[model samples]
Each structure stands twice: as structure tokens, then as C-alpha cells.
Target chain A: DVKVTQSSRYLVKRTGEKVFLECVQDMDHENMFWYRQDPGLGLRLIYFSYDVKMKEKGDIPEGYSVSREKKERFSLILESASTNQTSMYLCASSPSDSSYEQYFGPGTRLTVT
Target chain B: AQSVTQLDSQVPVFEEAPVELRCNYSSSVSVYLFWYVQYPNQGLQLLLKYLSGSTLVKGINGFEAEFNKSQTSFHLRKPSVHISDTAEYFCAVTEGNSGYSTLTFGKGTMLLVSP
Candidate 1:
């Protein structure tokens, strides 16, 4: 079974603070993605890495960046936390091939105050 | 570019009642369709996927979806829903190219099962 794990289940940060949310996958998949899920807006992608040290911006990448130092670990960085940035953060991974079914982590709910 | 639309935002039904969540999409190329379930605070889980062969696809948890190429729709259905089946359902699509496999998701539909 494929397993994706996030660093924290819940996190609270003050405004203007830098925050990092970590994600790790045990399946050795090649594609990793970060998304923020909101109530009505659904899930919007923040960033994704197809390979180590490579990153691509998604639909909503503003004020956020990602790091993929290793294949199994992908990290999401919030340069400066804001109240509007609070949402459920999800991490997912898929195989390098055409199989696009993403395996997701439990998710990290971030709160900015 | 590919886009998905889930028509209903919420669907409330009694236990043992049949239910359907509608999804439509527009894409330039042939597409792959998928339905995912998110329980409360959890992330998305694949319910089913339509790749090529079958128009009717069965998934986990007794859920199924039908792919209609001409209509550009993939609707999910379950015969009898339980309280445990309550969750948010999201429909997603991606270009079916062997090389490209990024997904575009729709605003999800919440299914509330009442006892």
C-alpha cells in the first residue's frame, strides 16, 4: 500500500511568521504535489515536483514555495503567514508513468492568526 | 486546458436511498476521469477512474461512475448509502496523453447521509 505522511496534523502560526509543512511518501513515486483546500474553492494546487530539485508552480503559488531535496520528501514553505493563507494543506504523489491517480496524505490544517 | 464542473454542492438523502453526484468536464484532448472521496478533514481518496475500456466503472466502497464521451459527463452513484458513506466527492480530469498526467479538479459535492 502507498503511504503519504505530512509533518503535522494541525499547526498554528502568527502573521508574518515563516512556516513549513513537510510531506513524505514511502512509495518512491516520481511526482509530488502540494495543494490548499478551502470550503467553496475546492483544492488548488500550490506546487509540484516531478523530480528532485525541480519544482513547478501550480494555480495558486503566490506567497508559497516548495522544496524537493529528496525523492521521498517534499516540503511546502510559507514565506510569511497570513490569515487568508490558513487552509487544509494536502500532499500527494503519483508514479512517473501515465498513472495519474494521486495518493494523498491525511492533510495538515494550518491556522494563521 | 482541461476543466471539471460538479453541478451540486450538497446532496442530502436518507439511508438506503440511491444517490447520484453529477460531474461534467471540457477538454481539448481525450480525457481521463476520476471520482474521489474526502471524509471530513482527510485528503482525497480515489473512488474510481475511467481510462479507456469500460464506460461503467466500479469502485471501492460500493460506489460506481459512468463515463459518457459524447455528453462529457461522469456521474457517480451508489445503490444504498450508509451514514458512514457521508463525505465530499470531487471529480477530476486530465488529458489522457501517455506523457502528460496532471489533474484538474472540480469544486466538490458534499453528500450527507441521514439515518
Candidate 2:
């Protein structure tokens, strides 16, 4: 079984604060992704990393950045958090050679005030 | 580019009744389709996937989906649902031959199963 774990299950931050959401996968998958899920919006991709130091922007990457210094870890960074950024964050990983099936981690619900 | 659309936002059903969740996609190239279920406060789980070979794909939890190329639809169905089956269902698509995969998801459909 594949295991994807996030750093926090819930977080609260004030406006203008910096926030970091971390994800780690034990399956040694080559692709990792970050997404924010909101009601009526489904899940919007924030950023994705295919390999170490390699990153790509998805449909909605504004105000967010990602780091993949190692294969097992992927971090999403909000340079300065805003109230609009409050939502559930999900981390997923998949093997590059597989059928594009992603394994998701329990989401982190972030609240910005 | 690939995109998915789930026509229904919510579906209400009673226990032991049949249900269907509709999904459609548009893409220039062939694509892979998937259906995922998310319980409250939990991440999405892969319920089924349509890759190749078979048009009718069966997945976990006694759910299944049929891939229709002409109409570009992949609709999920279950013969009889239970109260525990209440959850949100999302349909996603990605270019089939693209070496790197990035999914385009549809706004989910919420299934409310009652006793």
C-alpha cells in the first residue's frame, strides 16, 4: 500500500503570514502534485514536480510556490498568506510509468484570518 | 488540453436504489479517464479507471463505469447503494500518451444516500 502523509491536518494563519504545507510519500513515485479544493471549484492544481528541482505550473499557480529538494518530500509555500487562500490542500503522488493514477494524502484544511 | 465535466452537482438516492453519476470529457487526443470518491474530511480515492482494452470497467465498492468514445462520456453506476456510499465523486481525464501526466478534473458530484 502507498502512503502519502501531510505535515498538518489543519492550520490557521493570519493575513500576511508565510505558510508551508509539506507532503511525503513512501512509494518513491516520480511525480508529486499540490492542489487546493474549494466548494463548486473541485480541485485546482497549484504546482507539480516531476523530479528533484523540476517544477511546473498548473492552471492556478498564483501566490504559491513549490519545492522538491528530495524525491520523497514536496513542499508547497505561500509567500504571504491571504484570506482567499484558505481552503483544503491535497498532496498526491504517482509513478511516472504507471497509468496516471494518483494516490492522494489526507488533506490539510488551512484557515487564513 | 484535456477537460472533464460532471453534469450533475448532486444526486439523492435511497438505500438499495440504483444510481448513476454522469461525466463527460473533451480532448484532442486519446485520454485516460478516472472516477474518484471522497468522504467528508478525507482525500480522494480512486474508484475506477478506464485505460484501454475494456470499455466497461469495474472498480472497488461495487461500482462501475462505461467509457463511450463517440459521446465522450464515462458514466458511473451502482446497482444498489447504501447509506455509507454517500460521498463526493469526481471525474478526471489526462492525455493517454503523454509521458508526463497532469489530470484535469471536473467539479464533483455529491451523492447523498439516505435510509
Interface RMSD of each: 1.4, 1.0
lDDT of 1: 0.93
The i-RMS of candidate 2 is 1.0
Candidate 1's C-alpha runs over 4 A off are B98-100
CA displacement after TM-score superposition, residue B14 of candidate 2 (Å): 0.6
**Worst 10 contiguous positions by lDDT, candidate 2 chain A:** A93-102
In the range A6-96, model 2's lDDT, one tens digit per residue, is 9999999999999999999999999999999999999999999999999999989999999999999999999999999999999999999
Weakest ten-residue segment in model 1 chain A by summed lDDT: A93-102
lDDT tens per residue, model 1, B14-40: 999999999999998899999999998
Across B1-115, the per-residue lDDT of candidate 2 in tens digits comes to: 7889999999999999999999999999888999999999999999999999899999999999999999999999999999999999999999957546899899999999999
**Tens digit per residue, CA lDDT, model 1, A1-113:** 99999999999999999999999999989899999999988889889998999998999999999999999999999999999999999999999777689999999999999
On TM-score, the leading prediction is 2
